[model samples]
Target: MTHHTDLLIIGAGILGLSHAYAAAKRGLKVKVFERTATPLGASVRNFGQALVTGQPPGPMLDLARQSRDIWGQWAQLANLQLKRNGSYLFARTEAEEHLLEAFCAGRAEEYGYRVNLLQGAAMNDLYGGQFRHHRAALHGLDDQQLYSREALPALINYLCRELKVEFHFSTLVRDIEPGQLHSTAGSFRGEQIIVCSGHDYQTLLAEQIAELNPQICHLQMLRARPKVDLNLQHALLTGLSCVHYGAFADLPEAAPVQAQILRDVPHLHEHGIHLLISPTPYGELIIGDSHHYGSDPSPFNAEQVDNWMIELAEQTLGCQIQVVERWQGVYGSRGPGPFSFLRAADGVSVALMHTGVGMSVGPAMAERNITELWGEV
Candidate 1:
């Protein structure tokens, strides 16, 4: 059998869907194939928080801001459920507090978002005694969170209904056979192809692109159901605790500095501890996670890590939350910045990543790259 599409996208994760939506919006014939029965990869298996604050300055932050807007527009268009819950980063120690102050003061211009400085009784009053150890907190007005699990499925439905994106689920591609795709379902030929494989990089292409410089990390995330009514409206992050939050402390040749920062920031842990205390519209609070890094992620779930996260959440939220669900999300870290846009010999090029932030950056990156490639939109 033979089928032709103007744009063929592999991997129906968020990135693939973003690209497909962009191309279809441009009126291009687009088709997407995914190895899974449902589009459940890192995209759905995340905190679903469209984080805008705490990102370092530069193009990455710009892309994050842009993606947030796109997500908003798409949510409205698709009538998807989006929680505009704002986010807060708390500093537990004097040094951590200072760092938060510096962060709020430093990146205001570039990020175009105001990081409100909350300290002393104000911090304690708003967040309760849970953050009593901290001297300050960085609260961003424009920084909002999302429920990606709901968002992705809704986005997929919108793509099909409005943009006419053809999605082939459970159709695993065995090979990119020249100008054609050999899949479990059948064969598909296209004028152009875009491979959007996330961590399964080796499955899509023959050679590793230098720009990809992808690093893989395995993270554990938990969803919690509180015993009582929880009225948390904002996403929360602890200073000096989560690896992603205190990552700057571990820069190359900066162990001493990292140690000093950790010392000053008592909550900082080397294993990386960040929590998303956002209550879903359904009344479940999602908290997570700890990080484990390697070229290949080990198939192991550490109970100690889960315990540590639960302890952290119980202390922060002032409630003994019940862990209803837990899962692992593998992300491609240390990439050539954002995602890789590759053009292969078969005229099939695509973007790939291993994390959810790819959703936060998808629209701008997809629009820019797809326009450059197909010369249509």
Candidate 2:
């Protein structure tokens, strides 16, 4: 069978869905093909936090801001659950605190949101989350989160049912031509095609993107049930996160913070581990993760990494956690870029987020790409 659409999107991950959304909003007939029955890639494998605050300035940050608005629109349109309640980045040391101080004092407002500077233990007093070593905290007011496991599917359904988008799940694209692509399910034709197949660059546009030498960034994610009611309203991150996110990495104070963390925790940078804890509406906690990158990512999920994360979460929250679930999350990374976008032969384009910020920036990127390809409606 042959399917024809105004726009054809490969991969049903966040990027693909975002493209579908942007195209459909332009009144184009859009069809999406996914290798898996559902989006099982970086889209759902993450903490579901938007992390707009973590984006560096320029194009990446601009895209994040635009995507945040789109996410809000989708939440209401699709009746999806979204926690508009921001996020928290805490300092475990004086250096980390100084970084947050300088960041807040300088240009955090340019992020298009308010960032409240909180003293070490003040978070516990206001939000009931106890971080034992907190020196200061940046309460980023714009970051949002969705329980992507549920919200993403709901968004797909809304796209199909309400916006008239078509989706072919479990369809593997075998070949790409000028205006068409052949999939396991059938042949699909579109005026424009977008290949956002997460981490499967070799299968699509190897020549255009392979030279960049992107690797699979392997990560460990966990869901735990806290022993007590923490009443934490905001998503949480630690000093490791401050240094890890590009937003603060450029701050003069960030170098010392990173150095201090490396000196204190020898295993952290070794394993690319950072601490992020967020709550699920159902009362479970989302905790994670450790990073390791390679052409072929490790099949082994380190037990020590999971143990370390749980320990860190416990210390930060001042409560024990019973881990209910665990898994390995993987995404394509090109070392030091936010993402790589390239055009290929025959109206085909490739967009892959090198960082896990795809969920936060994909929609805006899609909108921009679609406009550049076909011009705005």
Candidate 3:
């Protein structure tokens, strides 16, 4: 049977769901298709950090802030367990610390986001007194983190019950042409088509669409059960992971990058790590992240990264951690620009560039762009 709707969204990940919610809210009949029985893509695979601290100043940063506000509002309306752990980024070295201070100085007032520089006893006291090894660090107050594992299920349930969006799971789309998409189940046609396919861009769009050289980075992260209460209530980041998040890996002078990693985030860089510890209302901690960038990297989940994260957790929060869960995530790779919205043709748009922070800006992006295209919603 052919499924006809006003709008058809391919790839029911965070991006797809965003479109579903936005379109439906605008009174557009929407149908979303997911290739997996469950959302196994980066949308649900991430730590669910609606990141705002690391976004560089400009439109991307503005979009992130807007999306973040929407996430909080939606979660509250939907009654989901969302954690508003303000995010922090710090420099562990002198040079790195200076750079962060410079960054904070310029945009501190514009966004009304506070970025504080702490040191000596002040720094120690602020960060649990365990990470006294840092020279300087920047903290951003007001941003929050989401548990993707929980948010996806909650959002999907809410959308189905309230918005009347149709979701077809375990349905792989074999082809997407001008006005139709072919799936294993049947054909889906709509007035407008938005391709939300993440890393699978190659399959749906041809070389012309993908010539932007969209790639992906594979990462390994683990979830651990803490032996003791961390008493930590923020998304913690250090120089090592912050540098990558700051999108400055390929800087001409590599020394500044090193200084930034070690000086700004000594605690994290010394161990090559950063952690997003959201003490699940259930008492477990979600600690992660080690990065490997490539179009298609080798299988990268390492017991070593897990061990390293656990050890860092112990050091940062002064508590022992037990390994309870482990996993890997694939995020869109860096490209010429921050994000891309290629209007391949009238009524056919391709949304790309989650930048590992899609959760931060997905909904607003969907609502604004789709509404502009459709002219009513």
Among the numbered candidates, top lDDT falls to 2
Alpha carbon lDDT at 217, candidate 2: 92
Let me know the TM-score candidate 2 reaches against the reference structure: 0.96
lDDT of 1 by residue, 118-229 (tens): 8878877884565666567777666666777787888889999888888899898988855689998899888788888777756767475444657677888888987766
Task: Report the CA-based lDDT of candidate 2 relative to the real structure.
Answer: 0.85
The local distance difference test score of each candidate is: 0.72, 0.85, 0.72
- On TM-score, the candidate that comes out on top is 2
TM agreement with the true structure for every prediction: 0.89, 0.96, 0.87
lDDT string, candidate 3, 199-290, tens digits:
77567776645678867777767777767666556677665554565522333333686765566546556433565555555667777776
- Sort every candidate by TM-score, greatest first: 2, 1, 3
Q: Model 1 residue 221 lDDT?
A: 83
> Which candidate, 2 or 3, has the higher lDDT?
2
lDDT score for residue 96 of model 3:
61
RMSD of 3: 3.5
